[model samples]
Structure formats: structure tokens, C-alpha cells
Target: MDLKSSTVLITGGSSGIGLEIAKQLLEKGAKVIVTGRDRAKLDEAKAKHPKLEVIQSDVADSKQVETLKQAITSKYPETNIVINNAGIMRKINMHENRALEDVTREIEINLMGPVRMTQAFLPHLKTKPEAAIVNVSSGLAFVPFAISPVYSATKAGLHSFTQALRIQLKGTNVRAIELAPPGTDTPLFTGDEFTKEDTAGPKPMPVDELARAFVRGLERDVEEIRPGVSNGLKWLSRIAPDFAVNMLGKSAQNMRH
Candidate 1:
């Protein structure tokens, strides 16, 4: 719970929300190790924050996940916090032709990636005095976003998994926390990641604002940290599931039309 002397590992920490979370953690005196798939982006992140210990690893690969687990456990034995923040999104048109492997890339990274990472690190995390597993889900987890069908499905699955994980780990030293963030102005949803038309929704929460809310949630030991519109979406989904899904789908109708 106390980040002052904690050692943390964040996957896909080179850019976007992951990078922001890593920076805020460093300021709180936590030893942060960031892993990513790209060497250049990792280098850029390290250049910005000299305190970061950058490792190149893809969470989507089982071999690489094992290697990362071994490396972190062996090298940074003090690591008590693991953040499963590595994820990707796209505005996919399912009607278009594509390989099955390519069609399910989001599931591999967003859902299975966190599941594998948590399983690999659970033993090590339990050995600590206090530990935490943070999974970054999405606001879309509450209701399907029509344009990114696969991406939304993965997030919904992750949300359910995190809930079950928390129940299983009850009375344990390790805590499972889910961060369901609304659109944040990150590379994940910005630039060429989505077409200009695909981004037609509520303005994204500022990255710094989201980071602040996240740190506060950790300190307060909040189990689910849903920032900005994410909180509203969850409430709406619970009260009016059909209305919520249809409203969100309206924003994505452009993709089909």
C-alpha cells in the first residue's frame, strides 16, 4: 500500500498511460522498471526519466512473459507491485477480410497478456509484505464500442477476470486492482491509431489527470479506479444496459456506414 519504498514493474510502459503512471510512481520514491516491445520507445521513455529501468519484452508472447518474470524476480527481488498496463486498440471493420490470428490480436494482448503476467508473478508477489496487481481495463468494458468490436470485447473480458481474481485472492497479501479508464489523450487512441472520424466521442481525460486519479486510488487502496466518464459509464450500464450499449454504438456507426 505504501509506495514510498515499493518496487514496481509496469508492462508496456514506453508510452501513453503506462508511461504516465511510471513517472508518477517514480516521484513517490518507488523503484520502477518499465517493459515494452520497442527499443526506441523504451529509450525515449528512459531519456525522459533517467530513473526508469527499461526492459524490452512483449507481453503477448508466452516465452517473453516467462523471461520477463524470471528477469524481474531474479534481478529486482524487491518488486512487490505489478501493473499489467500493456495493451493495444484498433478501429477494426470485421466485414473486411483478415486472418484469424490478426483478428484476435486484441484478445492476446489485452486479456490473456494480463492473465499470464498475473499467474507468473503471483508466487513472487505473495512472498512480499504487501503487493498489488493492477490491470488496466477500459470504460468500453461496461458497454460494447461497436467500431472496435474485438478491442471492446477484450476489455470486457479483462474486467470480469479482475473481479474474479480479487475474490480468489481475498485475505491474501496481494491485491487485484482494475483501472477502467475512459478515453485518455494517449497514443493508443490518438494519431493514426484511429482515424479522425473514429475518434468521435467524449473528449479524452487528460493523461496527467488520469495519472493523478490512479495514484490516489492506489494510496486509498481503491479496488476499482474508474476515472472521468468511465465511472459514469459503469453506473449507466448497471441501470440501463441496453440504452448504454446502443448509445455507445451510435458513436461507432460511422465505421459500418
Candidate 2:
């Protein structure tokens, strides 16, 4: 888990947390490749960090996922770290009429995207002397956020998948690490999803702080890295599940009105 010598590929790396992680990793001397669907954003990221290898691909697309795997693995044989960080979030009112496909978009990108990428890149990762797969989940995975029902569900499933993946990869060179982050000061929240009430609470962890914690976890070869309040959410989910849900539901109630 020495990131200094690892070549890493991070999906959704054009903005927010992913971009921050890539920048930090690059500073640590890791070869970093960043992928996103937006050509402009990818270009912007490349402009910011000249060392970044940019790939324009969407994890939600099976064909593109395969193409990315083939391209990166062949191009950077030293690639031993894959960070499945690509995802999207939306506020949907289930009571309102919506297409089934639209309703399930979060599940497709947030949950299935990682599943696809891991399946595609795992064999290549295993061949290395030491490798790591980091799946970024959310604190909401432990406590469902009623406003972002679909988004929360996907992260929950991803948390479960990471647990099982670790067990399956036991005694192997490839280490499965799950990074469950609490509400962070990222574009993912400050964009369309934020409400007055959502922003009224305590400030979230800064992106750089989260990135630093991630590198610390990587250096320690940790199995799970929960930053900021995410650790509290995990404990609350286990000891007081109903209370945690109710507390989260209160925040969602604001969005409902």
C-alpha cells in the first residue's frame, strides 16, 4: 500500500474529492490517471496537474469501462491501484411520476459502476506484488438519508459489496479498502442537492483534509477509512439504527417542503 510507487487510476477524477485525491497522490510520487465523461473538466484537471493522465470514459457504460481497463492496463503496466470514485446524486420525489430508468440512475452509476470496474481490473491488480482497490462509499450508506433515497441505497449496497470483496480477496496481494466519507465540502453537495437546512449544520471536512486522511490510511494499509463524522454514523447505525434514521429523516423533511 505504498502509494509512492503505485500507478493509480481514479474514476470521476475531474472534480471534487476524486480530483483532490489524485492531486495528493501525484504529490506523493504516484503515477495518476484520472477519468471522467466531461472532456472539458478532464482537460481542466490535466491543466491543473500536468502529470495527470486523463481518460474520457463513463463507468456507467459497460463498453467504456472495458475500453478504459484495456487501455490503462496496457499503457501503464505498473498500475496497481484502482479507485472506484465515479458517482452522481439526485433529489427525486418518488410520489411524483418519473420514468423507472430515471429513478434508478443513482443505482447504476453509484453501485453497479464500481462492481463493473472491479471485475474488469481485479485480475490485473492481483498480478502485482501489492495492489489496492479503494471504493468510496458515504456515511449515508450507514444511515439512510430520506431526501436522497436512491443515492443512500446505492452506497449501502456498495458498502456491502466492499465487505464481501475483501473476504474474497483475503490472503491476496490486492487489498480491498472502503473509504466512507461523511458530508464533505465537495461539489457533490454544494451543487443542486443542497438546501438551506443542509447547509445550516456544522461545516463538512475540507477536501484536502479528507485526502490527507486517505493517504494516511493507505500508508497504514487499513481495510476501512472513515473520515470525520462517517465513523460516528457507522457506530450509530449499529447501536441505534432507528435513532440515526430519524435524525437523518429530519434533514430530509426540510427538502420535502
Candidate 3:
């Protein structure tokens, strides 16, 4: 769908890929509203782009998502695009002693967040003449990252969910698109426990370049926009699923402390 003149809501748009996407969309003449959990970060993002509408909401919380849906729909009735970009990732050693809740955080934010947001916004999106839902999954969705098993699993689930959503939304105004990003230079990968070596394959994609690729993909109507190593991962998963899994497992072995 043409991005110009579209009203877009991007979750976790305060920084990283989401922020980059918002910046590009604004440049493309789209009305952009960005949501984040931190009010300070949201304010900072707004400071950078005065035209950006910043909302403080946690995608992981179902109640907050409901409230966010109502607030956005009421104020920005023209909103026709929803980008489920808010997510969290952790490098957890499953064998280590850890709180149960901590182990599944990726599921809550990475997987369920988009699922709930889609449910909350699909009805409104369908009302528009043309609308789109972009879910930012990961290349790991096709092959498990052994070091980040849960994160990979959640992304895999999200990939499946997006495919189903696309099929279900067939014949409707809303179009579901999945963006399976390769490792990107974002805080999600630079967290305390993570290092360059910890990443399963190559260095992260530059955030700006990745964002540009996404916009181009959307303009071209690509259903699954897998950039860089992500595209390779998709192909590898299809032709050499076992080898791909083994290679990723070896990468995790290299990451072991």
C-alpha cells in the first residue's frame, strides 16, 4: 500500500527499528503516531520530531492495549496502518537458575504483544479503504537460535500467526505483512549479557538501512520482507533445515560463557 497520506501507529517507535521506521514514514508524508513504555524516551523522540505523536503504552499488557486502541481510534480515526514493532529479547541460559516469569518474557512482549495488538486494531483497520499490519518478527523464526531458544520460539510462533492472519484477512481491506528482520544494531542485541559473538550469524544490520529496506518492501507489496541474512535464513530453512539448525546451534555453542 502507498504510505503517503496513511495514518500509521508504530509500537516501540521511540528508538531502534521502530524509531527509524517512524522517521522514514514521516519523511514519506505519512501521519505517524509512535508508542513506547517509557515516557521520557517518548518525549525525547518527540523532541527530535515535533510532528510525531507519542503515546506511552506497554504492548505486553492486554488492558493497556485495549486502552491504546480506544485512544488512537478516537483521536486518529484515519489510522490505517499498525506496525507491531515493540518487543524485548533476552539471552537466558535455560539451564541456569532463574525465575520462571523471567524465562518467558520474550513470549509476552515479542509474540503475544503483536497478537493482542492485531486483535485490538484489526477491526478499525478493516474499516479503512486500504490498511496494513506489519509484524516485526526475526530471521530466527525460521531457525532456532540455541542461545536464545525462547526468543526464537516466540518469533517462530509470530511467523505462523502472521501467515494465518494474512489468510484470514483475505478479501478484506486490511493486509497483513511480516517483516522478519535479521540481527539489527539495536539495544535488544547490545544488552549486558549479549556480545557480537553471541549473535547466531553475522553482524547486525544498520538500523537505518534496515528501515529503508522495510519501506521499500512495503511499497513493492512484499508479503514477507526478509532482509540481509534473514532472506538467507528463510531459504536455508526451506532447503537445508537440518543444516541451518545445526549451524545456529554451533553459534550458540560459541556463545557459551
TM-score of each: 0.97, 0.97, 0.96
Q: Which ten residues in a row have the lowest lDDT in candidate 1?
A: 248-257
Collision count for each candidate, in order: 0, 0, 0
RMSD of 1: 1.1
Which of 2 and 3 is the better model by lDDT?
3
Candidate 3 Cα outliers beyond 4 Å, as residue runs:
254-257
- Least lDDT summed over 10 consecutive residues: which range in candidate 2? 248-257
- Worst ten-residue run, lDDT, model 3? 248-257
Model 1, 58-113: lDDT tens digits are: 99999999999999999999999999999999878877888988999999999999
List where candidate 2 sits over 4 angstroms from the true fold: 254-257
Residue-level lDDT of model 3, residues 11-104, one tens digit each, is 9999999999999999999999999999999999999999999999999899999999999999999999999999888777766787888888
Q: Local distance difference test, per candidate? A: 0.93, 0.91, 0.92
Q: Which stretches of candidate 1 lie over 4 Å from their true place?
A: 254-257
* Residue 118 in candidate 3, Cα distance off native in Å: 1.0
Q: Whose TM-score is higher: candidate 1's or candidate 2's?
A: 1
- For residues 1-257, write the lDDT of model 2, one tens digit per residue: 78788899999999999999999999999999999999999999999999999999999999999999899978998999999999998776666788988899998899999999999999999899999899999998899888789999999999999999999999999999999988788888777677767545557899999999998999998889999889999999999999999888876665542
- How many angstroms is residue 41 displaced in model 2 relative to the true structure, after the best TM-score fit? 0.1
Per-candidate alpha-carbon RMSD to the true structure: 1.1, 1.3, 1.5
